[model samples]
Target: MKILKNILKIFGILGILFFFWAAFVYFSFDKTEFLKTFQSRYSKVLYDRNGELLSVFLNQEDQWHIQAREIPQRLKIAVINYEDRNFYSHKGVDFLALLRALKNNIFLNQRTGASTISMQTIKLWDKKNRTYLNKLNEMIQSFALENHFTKEEILRLYLSNAPYGRNLVGFESAILFYFDKNPKNLTWAQAALLAVLPNQPGLIHLEKNKNLLLKKRDLLLKKLYDKKIIEKDIFELSLKEPLPHFKTHKNIAPHLALKLLSEDKKQVVSSIDKKLQIKFENKALEFAQGLKQKGIQNLAIILADTQTYKILAYVGSQDFYDLENLGQINGARAKRSEGSTLKPFLFALSIDEGLISPKSILLDVPTFFSNFNPQNANKKYYGLISAEEALQKSLNVPFVSLLQNYGYEKFFYKLKYFLDFKDEDYQKYGLSLILGTKELSLEDLTQLYLGLANYGQIADLSFLRDEPLKGLKTMFSKGSAYLTLQSMKNVQRFGLQNYDKTKIVSWKTGTSYGRKDALALGATPRYTLGVWVGNFNAQANANLYGVSIAGDLFFELLSLLDRLDLEFQMPQDLFNIKLDLMSKYRYDERLGGAYTYTLYPKEAKILRTSPFLKRIYEFQGKEVDSKDENFKDAKIQIKLDLPLNALDFLHQENLNFKSEKNIKILYPKQNLNILLARDFDKQKALVVKIANLKNEKVFWYLNQKLIYEGEATSRILDLKPKIYSLFIISESGESDEVRFEVKQ
Candidate 1:
């Protein structure tokens, strides 16, 4: 018995000596360094499937921070009453509580602890194992800290800095998140909530144990009353407070906050409303599943607030988690061919280069570019058209010609200026840019689209909270984006605006080969979503155009959000420019070019209504000679003869129709005839139709007061026996009627 007592007394002395040594050591060092050291050991970032941020992943176990002040009086009373009744009166050691714990363990044969809040905090920081020495060291460290910090300071730091589940590590963050406000603002009910988390924050769900929270809160309140911290009335009043009345942590900005909130060691607490993430994520998954079944192997989408650009949801793929190869290749901004969707950029570029204005004339005729001659779908030339008209039709001939004229290098440089890309950005995505030949990820398109939506600003996207991205160059003039937006709203004019029947949705479709397709990284006043639908296996579907797939998908999905209420915001000088507009009628008098070829409107003009038809000529009357007889079918012949050189000149200059006065009149052949209204008014045009002798309708031209009906007998004017059928019409269906004079 004496030996055992001697061993026990020696053990007690050693413990005391060890505690004193630990206290001395802790008092000599800085706490900030200690905190930093703890962080270096553990920190990991979390992200949503769409490459969006979720939060940081930290802690081997769950813990949470709550301000000392935020902890309810009843909560504080409950913890101290159940765990250590002398908590307020003790230094870090809590001698009385330790004695009681020792008696309980010795008598009851169970493990018991008597560490004060200060000692608890000290143990949390210590990485050493939970040996007797480690516990002594924690007690010593707590004692030393007591000299530097007050009881409240120790409590504040302890509550302000504790691991709360994965990544959450500070009281300020926890209180704001849990109570949805500052720690000082936590109500009595909210304060009780914090205590429930310390046992195992993640495992604890207050909602699942409403009775437990109430019971704990009541016990704590009763203890506080017994300890004299609060009166009986106050304790009862606090008990009456609700369980979830304090703020909550439902992370609303799930996607945006994911990127913004994940960072180095520190806690990120913001107004992130993650309450709708489940619904949003589910919807996104549904879209991906639908696309996958249709062989649309890959896709990316982003949902954002229209006014503030705050991202609501981001569904970048059918299943990013399932595919190891997806989203791994594309950076935050995706890269891909823009297809015809890039036309707007070129149109704005042209306006800046002074190559052509909106009203500039463009002959939308069949044009060739190297070996690649492009044509419109309808395959008919619109004789002369304006730049706007060409854009409206998405006419390839004009765009190809315009790009060639603008100088590919110069245009590339211009694009570089707006894109302001790095060498790697270009290397990974080069020549294919202009032709949309290169592949782009969905994010890249979304960023570019952001430039369009933000009125020429390229927002610097980042994934770190408190590290705001800065210093971005302007991609384009506000006027340019504004102009593009306004012009694009006219998709209806081009007959392709059946996209969103519900709202004013402005979008563009890009189809480059079968493997590439896009339905804009576009925005209205409410939301912006960019979608890409294509075979991930590099198989292009000839039948699936960009307009039909991704475009359709985007419209269908966006319609579910709500109607996009937006208007066409036009520029100040919209379509106000002096350009060489095209004219179908040419005026060159010497070559039968009329000084004024009156094309009287169907409606009468007030100034002059007498002459309904006017045909100007370079030669007539006295000029007529031996050329009159050959007039075909007893009809009048109007012709002007010119030198062969002049004919070649007209052909070279593309002035064949310009010199109307010089074209020779032709006569109908074989069974052809004429019905001249000679006594009819010369001021009016007579509708004329002709036919072969078999009575089948044939070619005819309208002439002044001359009408020819099929199968009609030749009708002569007031002139004396005029020879008809003078112009030879061969039996082979070819006719030669040239150089006949007009006798006036």
Candidate 2:
């Protein structure tokens, strides 16, 4: 009875101590199964109106990962078979497998792994790398993990916890690396291949060592076959299968992905219009290939929706793919400058300052700055053209003139405020901003163009769709934006402004000395294009300057986009002045037939000319009452006695009605003089000679638009106020256009 009593006491003490030990382990067990850095680096993603991803921004220094459920079953099964076959039936440690491993390591003289799949998982999740204390901690954590998770859950943890190589630490990434597909659709053989990578990843990179990969694949197949996991025939088939040549799209910014992958845990939907993306890619590829055929090896292209500032497609290079190149890279991560593509913004600024209007004249002449005289593209000037003409033709001199006209500091301040750029940012590129001298990037260029496309508002360029930020602003006014758009259109003019009018294309071409520094910034009603063609090192200089070459390609691509309803919704807010002129003064009977007058800007009525031309000499008829300074309500009816059947040239391009083919009527002096405005220094009194009835000749002066046909001298006629060129054309096919401005 005493011995039995002592045995009971011993059992009680062991039981009590065991209970406390178990409780201690449970309390101290690490609940953290895995430590993954926050998924993204960027705070938010940029999306289009349709919620398409324009670009993903990240600032991380690690690999991107998908979740366990995000992976495929093939990978799951492959990982289990290769790493832990008894994962489904075992607790924290597979006792039977452990016993066998211990026997092999301690007695059979081999370093057999006693650590269960759970232990490996624990190490992956909570413990640090190889060390005695780490191993012990892994054991404790693994045991605790088993206490809470089921066998199946443990298997899942093992699958997700395992490192897939290349700093990608899970089944989510293993699938991406080897198969290029998500884990769910992973092939059996591909899964087997991923299973083999755990032993040694780098040596098995088939690109460098195909033989070694085949060896590892064969070993995996043998292990599976011996275990009866796969049929004999399946095992043999797997061994015979060759490695799929692995290729990857360079993760230009993997960190960018985390910031863009999700918004508030909701998976990101991109603002990337895929349809537009395909169109742009196909077109860019076609051009890049064409250039390659001609010895140009690379092309960088970006397609964006101008209206919403959504980046639709971007092809950094022609088949120029990589996996790890990030930061300052397009084709393999080399960033470059964005040239004349920056002009529209400056032009936009000009509009906001009211220093110029779309119709205001722009001079393409020699414009001097601090010892810098930027000339027209070809060092030739196209005399006094509208602001619209200067932009379409990409006249540098005129842009500089505008900058000078509107205080330079104020102009830059406008730019900085609108673009959210600092003074330093502008000083770096703005010195030559009047010219295309800024070394910027494709992404930056896209942002600026996007602002223009967004009706003068600049939206924050983001990679993530969520996360509130304040970056959007009306950098310029609607008027400025509208004017800028008009300027980029295919204008009706001479020289480089000439483009196929039928295409509805608006483009600005830019080039620097190096062939590598060429860019064509253009946009249509649908898309904006920024193409950079260049190389790394100094090769970019020459390779990039081929904008004209790229412009041809750009139009070719734009043609592929579905034809949209791009008809001009005429500017409703803008008002215009219209003049209805007539060459005919003679009536069908005597008082000249009544003419219908429909003017564009219904505001203009009285016939007005430049202030200088407002002074008319004397009347041709002595029988008529001469006009006076009080001719406020005065009206004059004059006649021209020309031979019948004589053809006459009428008003400008769209001719006005023929009031009477004989005489022109003038409004009262007071009313007419109100609209009189001009450049008095340019008004030249001309002489005209007219031969009347009975061979009598008289001399009179008249305005050019109202040429007397007869040699008239010393006469003035009311003409439209605009810049005009004096073209003296004789019978021969020769005429000289001498430019002169009539400001009225």
lDDT of 1 by residue, 413-529 (tens): 655554545433443433334446544456556656666676666664322323344435566555656666665665531233665554765566666744446454457766666
Writing each residue's lDDT as its tens digit, candidate 2 over 1-744 gives: 999999999999998986786667557864542333222322233333354333322224465343353445656666677777777776666778777977897888987676777888776565366776676566666778888777767666566556556655556455555566535556567778777775555565656677887777778778777878789888877777778754453332222233355544524554455456556656665776666665566656776665555556666665434222222345422445555566677777755554444555444533334335466555667655666677777777777767676555665566556555544555554446656564556666666676776566777654322334348887766556655766677532233344445666556666664455666666666777777665544354333443456566655666666543363233333444322122211112223323332212112122231111111222342222344553443444433322211112122112232222222111111112223333365443322111122111322212255343332312453446554433333222222233433344
TM-score of every candidate relative to the true structure: 0.60, 0.56
Worst 10 residues of 1 by lDDT: 603-612
Please report, in order, the local distance difference test score of every candidate based on alpha carbons. 0.51, 0.53
Error of 2 at 87 (Å): 7.9
Number of the top candidate by TM-score? 1
* TM-score, predicted candidate 1 vs. hidden true structure: 0.60
